[model samples]
Target: MTEFTEPEAKLEALLGIINSSARQAIAEYKKTGHGVPSADATTFHPLDLATDTLALKKATRLLEGAYHQLSAILAPPQHTVMNFVFNYNWACTNVALRAHIADVLEQHPEGLSVDRIADAVGLDESKTARILRALSLMGCFKEVKRDVFANTRLSLILKSANNTGCYAHYHSRDVSKYAGVLYETMIDEEFSRSHEVDKAPRVFACRKEGMEESFWEMMKNDDERRDIFHRGLIGHSEMMGTSSVLHQYNWGDVSSVVDVGSGIGAFSMPLAKMFPHLRITNHDLPEVMVQARNAWEENVPEALLDGRVEFVPINFFEDIPVAGKDVYYLRHIIHNWPDAEATTILHNIRKAMGPNSVVLIPSSSTHSKNLAVAPEPMLPNFGAGSHRVYQIDLTMWFLLNSKERTLDEFKTIAAAAGLALTQVYDLVETMVIEFRIAQN
Candidate 1:
């Protein structure tokens, strides 16, 4: 056995990891009976649309992590460092999404000339051509012929109808602005040390643009944006591969679930569909409750007929959820507030817990003060494998001045609410942390 303490042995170990993880990923694709996707393919592979992607995500995480580690070591340092700032894919993607470039291209699948594409989208021809070419380099759009472009599998998500595209749209349009002022916010006296909602980097950025409404207030007042934001949540779920919880968890044993701060029942809708036995309560603000009912009625009206799901309006910081639920699920909720308010939310839930009731938090582990480390010869948190997780942690900070809590931080807040951590499910991209009421 080669000792990884030496640099050469460590490099070899990473190479082995990259190889094995890649093969594992290939096997997953083959198991689907559709084989692997070609780089130049214009259509999505069957596996790309799958919901339960835990195994594939696992392999991808290691493959990405190990390969990036290897490249950083093997390649010149300047090349790697410059690549960070050189990335303008998000900007280019923003242009394509706003222009509905994919939607325009979809009508002419053979290929559309850049001039025609720009005309259809009402954009300048030369500028649009440049954007398409940049994205084509990344396989998002394909240059089928000189100055002509076609939608690739990667570009499909950018179409107006794709929910994941909505998620990308929000990030590219809104979050990118917030990110641009990260340095300014850090140095500003008012926002530098504040962790409150009003002091977030988004607030700082918006204030500079002469808009001062809080994030939720803006969402509530703007109907169009609220709709896009809700759809974006569905997109967020897909991108994170979070639906894996549907298969990974022991939902069969559970009967009732209270979806705390559940925005339009994204998680519970699928849960209710998969396990018809679950009695679900979706608790959110009064306005959101309206949207929830409409969503369920449109999507899963049968669930409502049997009384399998109920919509209850709540202000979680002050109001308590219904009593004695089998599970109080908070998906991407706790990370939206500062520690004190986060404790209040949990404490309120703790009040409604029965002896066997559990609280589940499906979150990115990147924000924790102490993440579970990877095995030897790998960067502890799986490096680039956890790229999105780390970026999400920063996103929370940018939008809400909050963060994904560390395990110790989670334990501390749970303790404050008379709850204790019982189990942790490493769902690759995000971990589902289970908490129960503390026994005195």
Candidate 2:
């Protein structure tokens, strides 16, 4: 029998993961009733429009992890390390979004000459072509012919009308600026070790530029950015497949749900659409209530007309939400604050609960060290497969001095708020954890 070396064992393990994950991914595509997508295909697969992608996400996570591991081990250390330093896809994508390059290209379906595209956008043709080419390498755009560019399925996301595009713009630009100051924040006298929202890297960056405002304050002051932000929340739901909670959980049994801090009804509106029988109350600050009402009226007009939904303005810190609802749903809310404020918000919601009412928080994977662990032969944190979740954790820190919690951390917070974890439903990207009042 031949003995395998440590490196050889690692390589074989990664190869096995890659083969299994790829097969699973292909199976997922085939289940959609459409054939698997081709790399050269110009359009999105039907699965792209799907709300439930748990299987696909699981498969891709493995595939991404295996391939990254294989590449790191197979490639030269200098090459692998330097790839991070040389990569600037975010900068290129930002330029494409900011220049409205994709929007302009939308008018030309076949393909537009690089000269015409640059001239229309008022940028130098040479520079614009360079940026597009860089993005094209990533399937975002296609060079149909030399010097002629066309939008791919991926490029559609860059259009101004796409909510995800708004989201991308916010992250690739504003968040990147905050991220640039991360090291400074770690060492700054005022910001170091602070969990306050005002001490976030975004705040730090703003202070240097002679402007300072809480994230909410800034949103309240700027109409355009605010619209983009709220719209992006909807995109965030879609990207994370948060609405899958509707299908995963037994929402049918619950009659009344209060959408706490429901920005533009990303979760609740869909809940109303899928199951029209449920009653929903939208709660937020007074200004956000205005926007939420407009969004509901526009996207889910029937819910308003049916008298099933009501908008209730709230300062959750000071106010107990409308009481006795069967469910108090807080999606993407708790992760925005530190332990003290998060507990306070939960406590307020707890104050509003009836004997049977539950608190539902939609979150990314819990960091509860004792909870779920990655499959064997995979990195404990999942390496490249968990790229987005970790980055999002950092983003919470940068944007609000907040962080994603482990299961244990969540339990502690819940305990502090006088609540107990009753159930946890694992979705593809977001987990919907349910809590009820503690008996003891």
Candidate 3:
């Protein structure tokens, strides 16, 4: 018989302890509705306060022991297999299979045999069964009996026709375009440069040529596809609109506001509805403006539409409509380009702004830690924030050459455009940086 190595023996011991402790914890929770405490919970250890003090510390000890054993086992050659399996399982189980299984179970509330699900979704029965089995192992669905599946809470929510079921559309083709670009860039380092317009064909050539033409091509004249894209934008806008920065703006003081790059009137329409007295001009490319008008006519409240909202076709980079307005709102637009182009967009707004006009650029920010090398702050003391924004910055690195910039970086761009940053209000992961024309 082969002798087990120290690390292997330790791993086996740790697994046993973990299984035993986990069972205890679950049993305790089920019976008493409280978790077992860590060994150091009552002890005078610095980290004791982070654990519960009432129960035995067996659970914590098992976790620490397991980590130590796993660290040894995970070194060098052993780690590659673990990493691949972990990532593969995460993508299939967490991202795809779980969602698909939940949808199937939800649609067949009476519970589904694998064949029924395959038939309903027009998938092969054998493939459907395999997917169901995989999801059942992940606790997304339950095998009620031999090859029969029933909805768990997770699966039931996935079936709803509302926001719950909307995950399918969110992860559909339109949004997946970015994901595909990112994945290809990750696998083939050469593909990284492909995202640069000069280096490769424009990825969004469909939209770059003409949004209307792109829309028809991308959606293939399919109403459902168009609606999915629209819903994804609406879902994203709803989250952004509810943020405090948007709410904190004094829209009452602004009579007319123009939303640059106002796709389907997500930001402008909401602003118009919120401030009934404030007339909003949803400006975009001619094609996008058509979509915006249709979206507004369908979704925007009638009360807000009584001459309060207008759809204007204007290429922001070329020239902004000369509207005397109190506020010029640009949301999520400036980040799409490099500083030079972004500055040009801002300059157009600066040229169009009236004296005392406020330009509200509701943008995102990033931190220094997540970068490959720490970036020098564009403005002193402006990069102070959370790591999530940095994650978004990295994401933009692949999607486009764009980035979520720090306050100082924003100020530098605004300065080039002849605008001065007056105030910045941080609201729920976004910043509303108010700017005005620089005084000569």
* Global local distance difference test of model 3: 0.58
TM-score of each: 0.96, 0.96, 0.62
**TM value for model 3:** 0.62
Give lDDT: candidate 1, residue 393. Answer: 91
Clash counts for all predictions: 2, 3, 3
Regions of candidate 3 where Cα sits further than 4 Å from its true position: 1-85, 88-111, 129-227, 238-242, 303-305, 368-391
Over the stretch 1-440, how does candidate 2's per-residue lDDT look in tens digits?
Answer: 33446878878988988999999999999998898987555567898777778788878878887898789989999999999887888899999988898898888878899999999889999999999998899989999999899988888888888878888888998999999999999999999988889999999999999997789999999988888888888778767777778778888898999999998887888899998989999999999999989988999999999999999999999999999999999988999999999999999999999999999998877444533545656776678877777788898999999988876788899999999999887774567788999889
lDDT at position 261, candidate 1: 90
Name the best candidate (by lDDT).
1
Worst 10 residues of 3 by lDDT: 372-381
Error of 1 at 82 (Å): 1.2
Writing each residue's lDDT as its tens digit, candidate 1 over 1-440 gives: 33577899888889889999999999999999999988777788998888899899889988989989999999999999999999999999999999999999888888999989988999999999999999999999999999999999999999998889998999999999999999999999998988899999999989988999988888888877777788888888888898889998999999999999999987999899999999999999888889889989998999999988999999998998999989999998999988899999999999999999999999887634334565558877889988999999999999999998777888899999999999888777888889999988
